[model samples]
Structures are given as C-alpha cells and as structure tokens.
Target: MRVLLVAYGSRGDVEPMVGFAVQLRALGAEVQMCAPPDFAELLEGVGIPLAPIGQPVRPVVKGVVTGTAPMPAEGLPQRAAALVATTYDAVAAVAEGFDAVVATGLLPAAAGARSVAEKLGILYSFVAYFPTYLPSPHHPPFERPGRPFPPEVTDNRALWELDFETMNVLFGTGLNTHRASIGLPPVDDFRGYVLTGRPWLATDPALSPWPEPADIDVVQTGAWFRPDERPLPADLVAFLEGGPVPVYVGFGSIPVRDSADVARAAIEAVRAHGRRVIVSGGWADLDLIDDQGDCLAVGEVNHHVLFRRVAAVVHHGGAGTTTTAARAGAPQVVVPQMADQPYWAGRVADLGIGAAHDGPTPTFESLVAALETALAPETAARAAALSGMVRTDGATAAAKLLFDAVLTAEPQQ
Candidate 1:
C-alpha cells in the first residue's frame, strides 16, 4: 500500500498533493512525497515520508513568470525545460520502491515520473488541477491570454490541437533528449506524451465543469482541500474583529519584480472602498511599510480560517487559491500574472462569483474596480451558493481511485 506522489512548483502546486497524501494515509496506505527541497520541512511536519527530488526550481520558474532575470534565448520555457532536465535523473531514482506513482501535472515532475513508472512497469497516474493538460474544446491552455475564440473555433478543437503542437515545438528538443536518456523513443504525439490512461482531474466539478463525453480516462474529482483547518492566531483574530471585514490579498508563491509596488497598489485599491486589508507576503517576498489603521500586512496565515473572516479575496488566481476562496464562500478579485492564472481569473467572472482583471500587472485603478465589483452583494451570494456545492473530500475520492488502480495493476500474490 505504499505510494509515491511526485509534485513540484510553489506552495500552490505542492500543498494539494500533500493533502492527497494525507488522505491515502488515512486509507491505510504508506505515502512518500517526492518534491523540491523547499517543502522538506513542510512534508516532514505533516508526517509524510519525504523522498526529495529536484532542485529549487521555484525561483527560476518565478523568473520566467515575472521577467525578473536574464534567461536563454527561448525565454521562460527554455529555462523551465533546462530545470526539468536537471531533475529527471533524481526523479527517476527515487520513484523506486513505490506501489503507485501519482504525478502532479507540472511539466518537469510529471514527465520524469511517467518515464520511471513506464520503465519499471509500475502503476502510474497523473493529477491535473487545472484544465491545461486536457485538449478539449471547452477551454484553451493556460498560457494563452484569453479565450477570444467563438464557439465554432473552440468547438473545432483547433486551438487545443495547436497548443499541443506548439508545446512539442517549444520543448521537444529537450524532451527528446531526456527520452533518449531514459531509453524511450521520441514522442510522436505531444498530447499523449506525459498523460496516462487514468488521470485525476483535481478540481471541483462545480467550479471547473467536467467536459461531457471526455476523450480520455479522466476522473473529475473535486478540488483536493486540506482535511484539517489550523487554528487562527490571536492577533489575527483581534485584527479581524477590530474593524470592518478586510479584503484578503495574496499572490501565493508567484514572484513579482517589485512586490512592494503590488502590495501598495492592493492596499490603496481596497482602501479606496473604505475596506481594511490583510495581505499575505507569500513567496513574492512582499515587504510592506506600516499597516497604518486600515491594513495588516504580514507573512502567511492559514487560509482555511482567514478567508472565512475576510470581506473579499484578491489574489493571483492560482488553482489552489481559487478553490480555497470558493470553498470559503469569499468573493474573489483575480489579477492573473501568468500561466494558468488568467484561465482561473476568467472562470471566476464566467461563474458570476467574482471579477477578473486582465494583464500580468494590473494598474491601481483597475484593481480598485475589480475589488469593488467582487464585493458586490450579488457576487457574494453567488460565491456562497457555489461554495455550498463544492465537494471538499477530493483527497478521499482520489485515494480510492489510486488504490483501485494499484489493485488492478498488481500481479496475483
């Protein structure tokens, strides 16, 4: 009953897998998490056995997202490809001694884990938190700015096909190199290169509706939420009670060139509406000046408890944050920066639960308007309504499926 969960990226990407591992353990399975060194302590604290793989690629990935550093000519994708290449050997080495390999859909980690599982003949599965991995007419890939296509265009699947082809064109050289190292043939179809027959869609059906008559063996489980809620800090509790309900602001672990500017903009935008603010300095390294009377800027706090007390949530629209806000029934202001963020932002607006501001870096006035719109009573009601429909036991459902897959794959004793 031992399993290996391979995940990478920042807290948003890693935390959900930890929650998934916890559920597997509750079902009487031994779970070992393969992740970056940044999460070593967090995994250990949760009592999950750690199988550290991959270097700290978070900074490099952040650089790609924020344009903060000088990269090779291929820009961010090349740097990401290089980072994944460096970790492939490490990922393959640690994947041994596990009954099943459940890989999160980070390009680097998933590709490496899939390669090892195939070579070893072990049961393999994948987790796609967002819709990026699926080539469906319902949505385009996350990196694309917006879904400007008409239904005819989207339904034709032209964009989906193009995205797959483009990925291969962009990263195929490095991917082919790794495939050769692993003694596997070069991929003929980029869409199927990193996918397995059984892949778990780790998002709530209510939020990201499952496409009907799916082409792949995809499981539309609800979002993998942490099973337990941490206690709120006394000072935070006092702050929440002291004044008007504050807007919760954070970008999770995504980096920005100048976080101070972003934070200042967030504070001012919310303050324009006479609302207090609680800002999370998540991996953005946001260093704020004094909170003054209307703002409380600090390091991370437990979102499960904090989001419930907030008037509205303003964030970068990561899959993890989007789901957390939905579960807490907090109206959201999504200011997407890069990758799948814009997709989630658009989704919030489509659902009528919140507002989405375009551009990687939104202006102060745009943020102010988005936040104001998000706090509208109708939007709050819509968010609350959706929250009630969101299933929170995604970990348990996913664990059951993985266990079944393991049983199905294992030879007779």
Candidate 2:
C-alpha cells in the first residue's frame, strides 16, 4: 500500500511521524512524509522521502516560547490557516494514488488532510500524541487557557460542550472556507469533523488512562519513538562518570526570553541540594558561568540514552519529552508554556510521579520546590514501576493499524 503521512508543527510534533514512517516501510508499505521545511534533515537522516510543507515553523514556535505569540484560543485559527495552505498541494498529490493519509491532530494539518482525503475518497486517520484532542468527563479540556478551572470541573461535561462550541466558532469559518474553495461542501460542525472517524491516540494507556467510551473507536498506541540511536559524546560520557547522577534539564524546541536565568535557576536548585546537572541548550542560548562547575551546558544530546542515566528530568512539557522521561523511569518537573503542555503537567501531578509548577514563567523559588518534589523517593519508585509496565511497540502497532484501516476501507476484488 502507498501511504502519505502529514505532520506539521515543531520538532516535537514531526519526530514521531518519522518513526511511524520508518515502521510502515519496514512492514512493506511504501511510505513518504510531508512536514515543515526545517525538518528536512531529520527526515533525510531517517531515510524517508520528504515533500516540503510551506510556512516555516521555527518563528511561530520561538514566538510562543518567548512570550510573543497570541494565546491559544486567540491565535489557533491563524496558525491553522497557514498550515492548511502548506498542506493542500502535498495532500492533493497524495490523493492521486495513496491508499491512506494520516496526520498529526494539530488543527491545521487535520483540517487540510481531511479535505484532501474527502475530495479523493481515500482513508484519513487522526493521530493524537496526547489525549488532549479526545474529550472525556473524567478529565479537563485539552487547551484550557488562562487560569485553570476549579477542581470539581472534571465532573462537568458541559465545560467540554462549551469548549467545543467555542472551538467551532473560532475555527469553523476558516476550515469551511477552505473546503468550499476545493469543491468540498462546508463541514457544518468543526467538532464533528474532529471526532468523526477512528482517530489514533498515540499514547500509552498507563500514562493517560482516559476512559474512552465504547462508541468512540480510539486506538490507544504507546508513544511513538524515532529510528536513530546515536551514541553519547565521549565528553558527555566522562561528565556522567565524573560525579553523582545529575538532573537532566532541557525544554526541547521551546525558546525562552532569558535562557541564562532559567539555566542559573536549574544549576542553583540542583547544587543547593548537593547534586550535579546536565543542561541541554535546546532552542535557547543558555551559557553557564563555568564549564568545569557541577553543571554542564551542552547543545542537543540523545534523550533516549541520557534520560536513563539521569536521576530526574526538568523540562517544558512537550508530549514527546514527557513520554521519553516516563520511558526512562526518571521523575519529571514540568514548566508548561501553552496548549497541551498544562494537560501533561496535570497528569504528572495526578500520577504522583512529578510536580507541576503553577506559572508559565518559572521563578527560582518555584523551580527549586518542583525539583525537590520530583527528586523524592516515592516519585522515583512510581516512575520506575510505570516504565516497566507501559508497552514499547508503539511504532509497530501504529503501522499495522493504519495498514489494516486502509485495506478494510478498500473494496474487495
């Protein structure tokens, strides 16, 4: 079968799609990918043929991390429109011969993919990295912006109903406008568009055990991981060996306004408790006072390997990083920025495996308190236990399910 995978967003969003492409190819399906231009090297490194998506994602991601972007409720439609325009041409090409098209459940990609699939009568499936897109009475809505709601909000599904209604008003016009231009009928309800088909939930049930009802055919695959496994640098190995297990701190792809302040907070918090640190200078430019101190500021390193050796992890709660931390049996300290981040933070705190800082901007005192809670013995024990029980064949399972869905949708000879 020929398949086209559409994934547009930050590095955190595209990396998992690369893993699914690799697995599908291994399972004998012809697979190609469409993503933002910045991820070309990453796709090439994994040997997947790439079709470029237009608008660059770096500026938007940087803006959000640095506090320049619009709030989620206010700016999502504009972002969605940009992504849809980039996705239209590539998805149109896929419609000619592809058996299936799957997309990351970001609003723009999902909207564009659905349009193309409907126009061509091909199977389209939604892949969610977290359960935020799927609504349930058991948990809060995915993108609850501003201050969090009351503790009793979980018992009220009307909040979800209201959010969905607001979503339709915010996003429906752009989606339907695009659909009409392409000779497709208007999608009356955007919420209906989102929850219509069998959307694949790409998360471990142990980590996000949402009680999805029998009516919704949600595929609960574990976290999808990348194919490459580069060895740690010799200097990093030496740093690891030189002292006690250091706390791993990195906010992958989320740029900060003052990286030095954040790095200093991390370094001071760890050292105050007599521990060492390994700081990942993600998109931000973080420089420590001295290279020879207990803390070492380095560029990107392999999280799969480094997380295993670390005592705990402190990060911005992107879905990919959160899953990696959980898989490595390391406790997490979540300093959320926007969108689904705060949801993951809530999950961590609920599970008793980590502490979530209350504010988007973390102060020294808050970071210190969160780190102390994350390093507790009970948190470590819970993380380790959960890691042992969570399934690891996410890529394989996702590939098989997509292939099956296509075959089933096709008319038999």
TM-score of each: 0.91, 0.91
List, residue by residue over 1-413, the lDDT tens digit for candidate 2: 98888887788888888888888999899888888888888888878888877767788778766778745756667756666756877778655788888878466676787778777788877788887677666555654443345556555476677677766766777787787788888776676575555677888788876575633566788878875589988989998999899998888877777788888887788777778988887776656746666887777678888898998898888888888889889899998877778888988898988999896777778888998899999999999987787667898899988777777785111
Question: Which portions of model 2 miss their true places by more than 4 Å?
Answer: 69-79, 142-155, 410-413
315-350 per-residue lDDT for model 1 (tens digits): 889999999999999999998877778889988999
The stretch of ten residues in a row with the least summed lDDT in candidate 1 is 142-151
Candidate 1, backbone clash total? 0
